[model samples]
Target: MKWLVPSAFMAVLGVTIAHSLVWGALICPFFIFAWVRYRPSMKIIAICVGVCAIFMALTSVALSGHESHLTGEEQRLPLRLAQPFKIKGQTATTTATTVKGESILVKVYLQDEHIPQLIASNSPAWCYWKGELERPSTARNPHSFNYRTYLWNQNTHWIFTLSNADDFTQCQPIQLTIREKLDQIRQQGMNHLKVVFPEKLQPIAKSLLFGDRSDIEGELLESYQQLGVIHLLAISGMHVGLMVGLLWWCLLRIGLTKEKVRIVILVLMPLYAIMTGASPPVVRAVSVVMAVIACTMIVKRITLIQALCLSIIVQLMINPVLLLHVGFQLSYAISLSLVLSAARILSAKSWLESVFIVTVVAQLGALPILLWHFHEVSFMAFVTNLLYIPIFTLFLLPSLFLLYLFSFFLPNVTFLLAGMLEKSVLLLDTFSMFLSTFPFATVVFGKPSHVLSFFYIIALFYMFSRWESRAPFKAIIFLLIVLCFDWFSSRFNPFGSVLFIDVGQGDSILIDLPWGNGTYLIDTGGAVQFGPQENQFSVGKDIVWPVLKARGITAVDAVILTHGDWDHIGGTLDLIDYIEIGEVWISPSSYEKETMEELVMKLQNKFIPVQEKLAPFSWAAGNAYFELLYPHDRDYEGNDDSLVIWAKFGGLTWLFTGDVEEKGEQELLSRYSLKSDVLKVGHHGSHTSTSQEFLTKVSPTYAIISAGVNNRYNHPHPEVTQRITEQGAVMLGTYSHGAIEYRFRGDKGTFQWMIP
Candidate 1:
């Protein structure tokens, strides 16, 4: 037990350094030893064990980061249409998620698929294609998912892609051993359960039984996440505990002794782990249960701390990478903290009081890591959990599992059970959604700094240790209030900023004034698909809305429509549905097009102000003001009618030229003084726009282009690049740089890239 803390720290060190060694790993042990020395009896022993853990962690990380295969072993050849690419002993798992026509992501293995050999391999080498391997995409933007590290944890680095079925001539079935056969059977069982369950309840059942979440809707998933009872959906300690309890109760009804029941549970644990795919949390849960049972049988007595420490040692020995997972960190933190504070919590006078104390303790323990990982904190999570935990864990989960199990023998009864499960799940979802809609349901703080997170964790531990001391409690409270204020200032303080979002082939720009006075949106990107199976992504719903919500933006001061192009105005309706819009400004000739006319009508129906044929005007809104520059007093059509706006703030002038082309640029150059510090390059840097004469006239210090990566049009054409370079302006494109942001205050400004 004395070695537990060092072992846990070492496991974390191993995972953190797996990709590359950091100096912090070497320095962290001294701090751990300093803290451990407080316990006088184990002071020397703790130091010795801590040193040993550090060296072992370093060795483990070195091995983990080593390449899975030599470069020379990789196959390479020019692919041809006529050549037959045969795939043997390969198994395709999961339905493909169609990214676009002929481009789908499915678990198709072009490598060796012999089950035994694949299992024995250290890496997911068996999942790669036979030809040249391409690395997976990594997160380069703020608050984006890190796909590369996620795959790395699963021992998968490269993913296979095919142009279509034409790339493959034939494939052989996978070879499986007895154990592999059982695993396949388990997968089939999950598939069958999905078919038997109702549509809404299917995802929950799959998550509970097999941890499959591909079919879950994004909105529903987000609601569960906000409610903080999302952990109940994952098969972890609570699920394991419920199953064990049920088994014990049945055995007791059959007149079995308590010792015999414990023995049976110990035997069943391994089987259950295999069935659940042995995810980190599942393995941790099973290990903890086994340790407790073993301690009971052998030592005849065991404290919760001893059992927990033993379980941590066992799980880490099996797979040290688990230490890097958020789930592993949170699960262990909550469990250990609960055990440590169990006496205080259990002493509550009422059952409800006990539940509230337990919930608060678990949340307090997990708070630092949660804030660091998620960038948001659920303010009412404890209350939601009190309602969600009993219904989801104690009743709904058990009933669903029993229904799934009994469906095999009495298939006719599944529909009735599924109906009951579906109703309960829907009710829970409604409650979660309603709760999440409340003001300040969750606070998005962005990712906290490492220094800040470390201090918070230290303060939390200090308060727990000195709970009875009034001074320490007051100090911790003061620390929290300070952190909250810091977060508020970071987001809403007086500072002007512009974000050029990556919206594929379309354009969307977010502009904010200093002191939070105005929030303006330039355009909303869109997708266009015809025929059956139309593409269903909305830039407003998926990209723009989340960005707004995360920043606590509920109302937009103005929405400027550049033109009626679907790529420009497609997401506007969706955005309007989600957030309040002040007014929409359109060009004089906008009503000439049916699309623009319909949009105006829709806005009027919603009682939102629409200003068509709006003359060129300038108005002050905050520290800065905006001036409409193009289509002034003239009725133009098509690309020439695109609205051009100029904004001046903090001594820097920004010119936002929509998809305006050569003719429109000439009009602006002749009619007005258009020199600016920053320019949004026209027509996504098309050769037809951003003429040399226009570039020379504007002479912008910085030029920004928004386009998709490897777009069919190959935007930001060479001619446009040359023109911008001739003007001595630094060029930035969303295709290569992701999102580009600039923060302006007074005479100075700073620029950064999402990838950087």
Candidate 2:
């Protein structure tokens, strides 16, 4: 029993970093710690080590087996539909299996909406599909998700793109397999659930009942995430327990024998697990119950811990890819903590005390993993879980279950209850959103260094031991001290940087002063929306924030918007909502534009200070001195009115021309002297900007351009590049390099490219 944790942990390592000898270090240290703490027998230790080796070998075999055959060329294949088509407007996506039984994702643009309706009527059980297969895209930025690695983890490497939806008409449909039939049933159940619940509650109902979280989007999702109770929204062990209890009660009411009830449950549990999407949590819950039932029949009892360990080993052995999923990691980690502390939990005198212990233990379990990946943790999570867990488990789940049962037979009753449920959920949602508004709900810790993460885990293990010993306060205080140290180190680090971020067809530059001086952004790159959307991507939330937070930057002294262009200022609007901000600067005339309306309102609402900077408005932040040099008390004239800035930092003179064109450049030369070691190219290096004469005047040694990859507006134009080249300046563009960074300590610095 003592060997279980080490064995399971090593299995995870075997799946994750089996190819590297470095991972053995992480394993060996843990083994020594476990030996000192648990004092397990030598034979058990050897067996655990043997188990690790076996899993490592199995993982190597599994991963090496999935090298892609897709050559990014059009090819015809008789493919069987692996999953139902998920249609969204003109486009739809699904999975298919080649005749060789290789899984490939299928993404298609529909000829018409009518195609989905027709396909739904006669679901594509199997089809001889024609498409172009290509490798999935990998992450292009630090801390961004890699869809290619994600697909390969699931033994899928190719994405089949169909030119037209009507192409499905070319193939004949074949009979469905048993598993396919079950999937269809599950899909139908989800649709039924959607129809039964109110529009607002559909996503929640689907998530709880079927583990389908696809529809759970937007601020409501964020609110749950902030509360750290997002896990409560998903199907877990509690849901499984409730379902089983409900089934057992119903069977007993029908006068079924107790033995017969157990048999029925055993037979139906796997079916239920399958129909509910078979998520990691769901599988763990189901496997444990089945294992317990089998053990009872054999007159041998299995401890809850043993059952849990067995499930982990069996699941990982069967599909090592589960190791890569965040959900899998969280589910197992939290569950293991609960089982290990079961004695303490059961010893609590009151239910409330038990709940508190459980919440704290679960938080401890999730902390290291969360910090390692997301770089933040919710401080409000404990409060939210204690308040909401009962509301969800005791009130919501039961009501939903009743509603689900009644929807089939009791229509009039169902309608009235559904309205009540929707209103109840709405009220909870409003409450949750209000809680999210608290500024300190979540604290950014940043991604920890490997050494720090190791120490944190070790400290957590020590804390768990103290909890088991009924002396937990010292460990709690110790943990808080460790957290403070983490924060202290992040703030006072001496390094400073000038980062040219990849904002895609826009501009964003970060100036981080040395030793906790200040941080500022020249622009917060925004997405260029073509039309209205249900949820348009936010560069601040999706791209910029991740990069910043990953680098442990949680506060900005000010965000200086070059112009009112959404591409330049739009991201700041969303960014200020999360990160701490002292002030925002814009061109004097830029604030009058319609595009700036939202930015101004959001900044004002957040009670952050805002100011307009013009020529002669010079300021110093630590050793960094900045001087505004353009748009002197004038009206906005679009790009030419961009707030041009000159600065001295890191032993170098710098110039940031915010989309200022040839005319504006000439004006700058006439009004002021211009020379810099580093230049932020104007208007993403458009030929309209960056005149040859202007480049000669600035005479920068390094000129960095920010632009999108294969953008509709071709930027960093050849003429501008030639001009920079003629000026004897090294030219770099975000489109080519991803991000261009100039890092320094005190007066010394070096330039680095993300791609390089």
> Which of the numbered candidates is closest to the native, going by highest lDDT?
2
Clashing residue pairs for model 1: none
Clashing pairs in 2: 505-708
| Candidate 1 runs further than 4 Å off | 9-132, 163-169, 177-179, 255-260, 462-476, 494-496, 527-535, 546-556, 573-584, 588-615, 620-625, 634-636
Q: TM per model?
A: 0.84, 0.94
Q: CA shift at 417, candidate 1, in angstroms?
A: 3.2
lDDT at 663 for candidate 2?
87
What's the lDDT for all of these models?
0.71, 0.82
lDDT by residue (tens digit), candidate 1, 620-662:
8767878888786557576777889888886788999889999
Clash tally, candidates in order? 0, 1
Tally clashing residue pairs in candidate 1.
0
List where candidate 2 sits over 4 angstroms from the true fold: 1-6, 19-24, 38-42, 75-78, 110-122, 125-134, 530-533, 725-728
Best by the TM-score measure: 2
